[model samples]
Target: MSILDYRRQSVRTAAPRRLYQAALAALALAVFVLGTAASVDGCTPARDPRFVGTATCMTCHKGITASDLRDHFAGPHAAIDCETCHGPGLEHVRAGGRNGILIDNPGDDPFGATPDLCARCHADAVDGHAMTTHFTKGAASCNDCHNVHKPGGFVFASDPDRFLDNAGYVQLCGECHAQQTGEFLRSGHATKDAVTCGGCHDLHVPATFTAPPENNQLCQQCHASFFLGLDSPEAVDFHTGAFHPVDPAGSGASRCVTCHLPPQRRTNQDRGPHDHSLLTLRPAETNALIAQGMTPPPNSCAGILGCHDASVPGSGAPFNLDHPSDNTVLQRFFDQIGGIPEKVQ
Candidate 1:
């Protein structure tokens, strides 16, 4: 062959070899890209097996299934997930063993968990509840008055008779608050079919017990007329005068319980107690004194006195000091004339 022909053939051979090498490189790059994508799609970080979702929790909690999602889940803790209280359960699901996850063991977790655990998201609740008599005595807990799954679902409406008939509810509260429950049943407020414990108390958020516009306001549900006149201009003027010792503004600001049912004794010697009779004075004693033709001491009238005395003959005497028959008026006149240190003053 000619020298030029040999050189041309050699060049053509090398060209095909180069083309083959280029094709192989392209194939290798495609494989590498595919491999990377596959790794990203198939391989994921291993999550702890003990981390199960709420559905897993619901499976074993069959008894509470009906109430598990009632009332649109309204309450202080309704938003919280089941795992938050039951703990992680991924390992339990995989191993088919119950030991891995911390299921709500009623026996072991009497309160369903530590109060602090519930307090994690409930810091404000813990602080406010601490101020209450329940928390101070250590009888209070997240589950003590509430069920995380079902909350505010079974509230007693205006009718309290139905509430008293609820066996389960009565048992739950009556177990510990036996005396208070009994007193509530026998109280005039309850006897008149006026209000229930739920009327003034928020079971879900016990910290917000006797909330504003409703704490003292709840009393007005029965005493609607009295309440209407209580804030009237004439009533304000009369109360501010010699009649009501408590200033209208001050009394308005203060809770009804603070004046009427003052905290005199506690549930126990060590516990802080609050009176539920809703009176400012002893009814039996005041009646005895009135029978003896003697007037009760100051701060004893209407609410201050145990029984309502709006109709008593001398009930309005002290307040109407200008009355001719009022002893206070006579005593004041004698004090001014005789200079006897003013018996009424």
Candidate 2:
């Protein structure tokens, strides 16, 4: 046979093979695209039908009626069905009890006291809390801190931003951290009913119960009162260009914690045992000071509980209350944060 004729025959045979390879590649690509789409949209595969609704369960367990279901139906999780967290109820309702809530065994429930059930929906939010002392070591449950059935902190309050008490988050949180809450209650902020757990805390994103130690992101959200400069409420602002030259973003005194919530000695493995008094060690109550007409203390709040002493300096600080910031040395001693480090001793 001629070489040209042989080449023509080979080309004709390769065409179908190439087409077969192309078809296989196309099929594989289609499978991959669909698989990814399913995963991204969170589509679950078919499973045995088990849910029978909250009404069915109430029928058998007459005592556990709609009254028991009222609180759960009213909260933010209102849309979520009882079966979502409590497994399914067809068997339990038929059999009559807690058997349906279990995963493997007949009566071993995963949600009685642990954060496991809540984690199913709140994995990201509970990530930090899950690793914290309260959840892990303390063996505390989600229900202990949050009344999952009835969340009324915002709904029941007059200010909508307050309560942190009286069926509010503050009261709920205080239930566990009683001493800390009590200390917080005595603080000027509490006295004014200005803040709550949700105010400084993003419960969904805490590093721990008290993981975040008063950073700028959390502080700026509410206390922008000083962001306006001398025209601010106290006729003194905390931002730059005020006499205090504070780095609002700074971590220590340059920020708010230095003097206001000065660090307290750690107790019970607490990292940031904040004073919660929220006091400036000897705040310049100008009007009250004028009435008293006496020279201010050398360091308004100098000591371990405050910031820098009246004497030494660092980061252009060591602000002295004795030599308070007037127009003269304003920028240098600006926002004078007093007190030496609590560890100074």
Top lDDT: which candidate number?
2
Candidate lDDT scores, in order, read 0.45, 0.47
- Model 1, span 1-345: residue lDDT tens: 999999999999978865654454344344434433444322222133344444444443344312234332354445555556656644443433233343453325653345666577777766666666666567666556655444442332212222433344445667777766666666676676666666666544545455543244544443335433444334433432433333334344233554444333311311324445554443344445556776543222233322123333444533331122343333343232211112223
Per residue, candidate 2 scores C-alpha lDDT tens digits across 278-317 of 6654444422443487653322234233244434344234
Off by over 4 Å in 1: 1-48, 63-81, 94-113, 151-172, 198-228, 236-242, 249-345
**Models, CA RMSD each:** 23.3, 22.3
Model 1 deviation from the true structure expressed as Cα RMSD, one decimal place: 23.3
Give me the runs in candidate 2 sitting further than 4 Å from their true place.
1-50, 61-67, 98-114, 151-167, 208-217, 226-244, 248-253, 266-270, 282-345
Clashes (backbone N, CA, C under 3 Å), per candidate, total 8, 10
- Score candidate 1 by TM-score against the native: 0.47
lDDT of 1: 0.45
RMSD of 2: 22.3
